[model samples]
Target: MEIKGENISFRYNIDSDWILKDVNIFLKTNQIIGLMGSSGSGKSTLCKILTGYINNYEGDVYLDGEKVNNNGFNPIQLVFQHPEKTINPKWKMNKALNESWNPPKELLDKFGIQQSWLNRWPNELSGGELQRFAVIRALSPKTKFLIADEMTTMLDAVTQVQIWQNVINIAKERKIGVLVVSHDKKLLNRLCDETIHLNIPFKIFFI
Candidate 1:
């Protein structure tokens, strides 16, 4: 399966400036693509468009040649840079993690999630711990494509490596396509099969 964004363009409002223009991107089930651009570039906006977050945009997004369905379980799952924003404050970690699928104990063990942390609220666990749960939740069996929008920005170096290790393993096991949006070139080079640079009124090119 593959996700394709063809001629994507966007702006905030009628009078606002355009955030992206004529942007084209594609992700295949067996590939890990890196999206990189300067500050204020529409990398995140494009991710939102691909994952059905922002609807008022130009052009089409197709998942394996079919248009994406906004309603119900989305095959394209997004894990944002901030875990705090990704998770619900009211729900406990256990409830949040198991919302879509019951993750295996081994996955939790690999993420280094303590059994005790599951009972605590999102605010109770540290940032790193909460992010582990968030990433795990995003890796449900139903997820065909996973979008990591700076997903590991908050964790320490060690924690970041640990999380990415688990994510890469899961992606390989499921043959899931991954869109890794990050400003860290080193991290991008380490994981991505190839990289694309997005410019204003964007033109995508290999970097």
Candidate 2:
């Protein structure tokens, strides 16, 4: 399976400056790739576009040569920078985690999520702890591609390393394509197979 973005351009309004323009990417299944750019360079914006979060863009996104549909749970999943924005405030952590599927113990354990935390609400847990649930939710069995947009930014270095290691293991085992979107050059160099830059036109200008 390959996910392709062709000539993607997006703006909040016609009068607003374009955030992304003419971007093209060909991401095949089971590969880990890195996307990096300066702040406000549209890296996160493009991540959202790829996973159907922002569907009003000009370009077409295709999976295995078919146009990507914006229906229910997408085969392409995205974990955002802020966990608080993604989860429901009224739901318990367990309910939020199980919203899509009952995640296995191994997944919870890998992220160091204690069983006790499941009973609490989103506000009770720290940002790092809550983000564990967000990542877990995006890693459901139905997910074919994963976009991690600064997903571990709130975590400490050690926790970041641990989470990334587990993510790589899961991706390799499940044959899931992953897009590691971040400004951290060290992290990108450590995890990604090939690195691409996002700038005006969104072309692969650099390796």
Candidate 3:
């Protein structure tokens, strides 16, 4: 999905200062746009606003030229950093995969993940396996845009590279827009078509 941000600014509370200020950006269709920042640089906040996770903010987010006031119009899916946090503790992996907008089978194959892993519970899976499953869940049928907020941060270097390659290739092939929030410059440079650095002490630029 194509998206644009116009004069976007956000603050948590009236007493607190603004986190993101006067940001403007336009994302190319089917391109990976990386949001790079330090831990407290509001990269996650920006992701939330873009994905309609946090709607109580300022400015307009447009998808395909229509304003996104809520989650209805923006079909952005997220593959969060911690797989344990996102997946349910009680549910089986198969159940979780089944609940995804698109069944995990197709995406697993696309990502080169073995089909047998689906039967394994979250606890039984390795960190890399869990992360890959989370990504597969996000990229399912209903996903038009993907908001990957530090999605692969916890994985080992090899797994990170593998996941990054899979995501970039699949996203481009499917014409899926990817909004990635990460601190990894190497990964960003490898996977993203455009990169923007956020969370600077005072400066801001959409690159």
lDDT of 3 by residue, 142-194 (tens): 67889898898878888777788888887888888898888888888878888
- List the candidates' TM-scores in order: 0.95, 0.95, 0.86
List model 1 lDDT by residue over 28-121, tens digit each: 8979989888878888888889999888899898898888866988899988777888799999988999999999999899999999998999
Task: Count residue pairs with overlapping backbones in model 2.
Answer: 0
Error of 3 at 91 (Å): 1.5
RMSD of 3: 2.5
| Shift of residue 131 alpha carbon in model 1, Å | 1.4
Off by over 4 Å in 3: 69-74, 102-106, 109-117, 120-127
Task: Encode model 2's per-residue lDDT on 77-138: one tens digit a residue.
Answer: 98998889999999999999999889998889989999999999999999999999999999
Better of 1 and 3 by TM-score: 1
Clashing pairs in 3: none
lDDT score at residue 146, model 3, on the 0-100 scale: 90
Clashes of 1: 0
The lDDT per prediction is 0.87, 0.89, 0.77
